[model samples]
Target: MAIYELRTYNVIVGKMSEVVSHYKNEGWPALAKHPQKLVGYFTGDVGAINELIHVWKFDDDADRRAFWAGVYGDAEFMAFAAKIRPLIAQQQNKLMLSAPWGPQP
Candidate 1:
């Protein structure tokens, strides 16, 4: 079964705009150099403000680990991460599997 990694980053209050700018200008560009694994990215407008969420799908745990290792090890991506790290207050990650019967994406 495919595994989905959900990453939620809580932006430091008042820093969401700057963080988004960096992600758009540098982060996504660097990540796009790697294999396609991203599902999409989301941000909140109502409750849970300042949260940046993105999901990625992988074949299994090894695939997931390998994908991250590649991204984390990349010089360009690391540069973007370094710039954005201080703007994030916290991050939460969860691995999920699709339900037995339902739409899968």
Candidate 2:
């Protein structure tokens, strides 16, 4: 089964656009190049108050780990993360797999 990672960041009001753009240009491309990650998307909602949601699809847990290990250790990724740290209040994430269907080929 394919897995998806969902992360929510509580971004400071004025920084949402900036943070989103940064992710669009840097993080998104970096993740897409990973061997396991298939795609990623971001969403913003007023209901959550300056919230940013990101969804990432991966082949499996091992693949997810490998991709993250590389991204986390890279100097450029580290710098980008640092740049957004102050603009965020807190973040939470969950890893989920697509639900299987009852009758389908």
Stretches of model 1 off by over 4 angstroms after superposition = none
Tens digit per residue, CA lDDT, model 2, 13-86: 78888988888787666655656454445566558758877777777888788878988877767777887888
Model 1 has an lDDT value of 0.96
Q: Which residue pairs show collisions in model 1?
A: none
What total of clashing residue pairs does each candidate reach?
Answer: 0, 0
TM-score per prediction, in order, is: 0.98, 0.78
Candidate 2, which segments miss by more than 4 Å at Cα?
24-26, 29-33, 36-38, 102-105
**How does residue 61 of candidate 1 score in lDDT?**
96
